[model samples]
Target: MEPMGLRERKKLATRRTLQHEALRLAIEHGSENVTVDDIAAAANVSTRTFFNYFSSKEEAIIGDGPPRPTADATAVFVANGPTGDLLDDLKHFILSPMLDLSAEELGYTFTDFLARKQLMLRESHLVTRMMATFAATEREVVAGVAARLGEEPEAIRPQIVAALGMTALRFALRHLHHHGDTAEGAGAEGARAAEIAELRDLLDEAFDALRQTFDTAR
Candidate 1:
């Protein structure tokens, strides 16, 4: 692949700077107390520049908005016929975001931001607000998955699949966060690859266990 152009590199640097500074300020001061101007000043960029990247201070602190399947993943979902394995397809759909990410490209995974958010949850109401937002995001995921499956969003099967997929994702992320330091000795790329592999393994195990439980019950 071609290297990022100079302008693109600069924009990425600025965005990373903004995210780092926003998290730092939110941790130091309460998330409620931190303003767009505060984050911009901390990042040494104008507030206008911050707006260019993130619409809200909470978004800056959270690293980005809620995770969604990428367009490529969505296309794959749409193209998949009715005979495909729903669980496996959903797993790949959820995993698509982290797939093909080089270490340099993997700036601040959700686990990192979530760990920091836990620390700040004590003093700020942002965590509560974010949870509400996440619920809505989950609904959106349910709708997307339902559409791909040619079912209603509220259909029992689609809802169950979406909920299980999201739960597995969260479980994988938390597991990685707990075990992340095991990869600290590796090089950056190696560490990221290892983490992704570990997450996939954990997700597979979770899904397999769920399948077994249902099969045994039947």
Candidate 2:
């Protein structure tokens, strides 16, 4: 990726400060007791500034939700491209956001992911907020699936396919949460390729199993 501009870097730094402070305060105290003002105070920013970066205290603690599919990626899928098969296309479409930076540039390291997983597990009360974010992401997936099929977003086909893709993703994520250290020791996208490839491999296995299950029933 190109170097971030000064404004972008400052914005990113501010967001990271809020995230780091929010996580620290929540872990030190209790998430239920940690209000937005408290987080803002801890970060040395006004509540308005805090709200500028995150919608709520919980949002800062959980970090950003899943990235959206790029317009180009969605258009390609709608045009039946990158590959023609539906299952294959869907997998790539969903994973594309994570893989956009290329293998050497994939920045989301497994160690970071594992740490986030542990935080979520440790603070189970925040699951509801996380789920709400996930629901929004699922809706995006459904919209893309529906568009590709020339159907309404409410169509069952879109919902089912979206759920299946999410299932494989969750499977891959759960595996990574536990075994991250085994694959990549963290830092740099170059070292993180194995971690992401593992995610792709697990997704492949999951979809393959589903395909076999359905084929045998037929």
- Whole-model Cα lDDT of every candidate shown, in order: 0.73, 0.76
Count of backbone clashes for each model? 0, 0
Provide the TM-score for each candidate, comma-separated. Answer: 0.79, 0.81
With a 3 Å backbone cut-off (N, CA, C), the pairs that clash in candidate 2 are none
After superposing candidate 2 on the true structure, give the runs of residues whose Cα lies further than 4 Å from its correct spot.
Answer: 1-9, 33-38, 41-44, 101-112, 177-187
lDDT per residue, candidate 1, 78-188, as tens digits? 667323777777787777777756575553554455556575557565666556655665676687688887899989977888888888876776566433434677666
Worst 10 residues of 2 by lDDT: 103-112
lDDT of 2 by residue, 158-186 (tens): 99999898878777777863343334555
Q: What is the lDDT of residue 195 in candidate 2?
A: 58
In model 1, what is the error at residue 107, expressed in angstroms?
A: 4.7
What is the alpha-carbon lDDT for the whole of candidate 2?
A: 0.76
lDDT for predicted candidate 1 compared with the true structure: 0.73
Superposed model 1: Cα runs more than 4 Å off: 1-13, 81-83, 136-140, 178-185
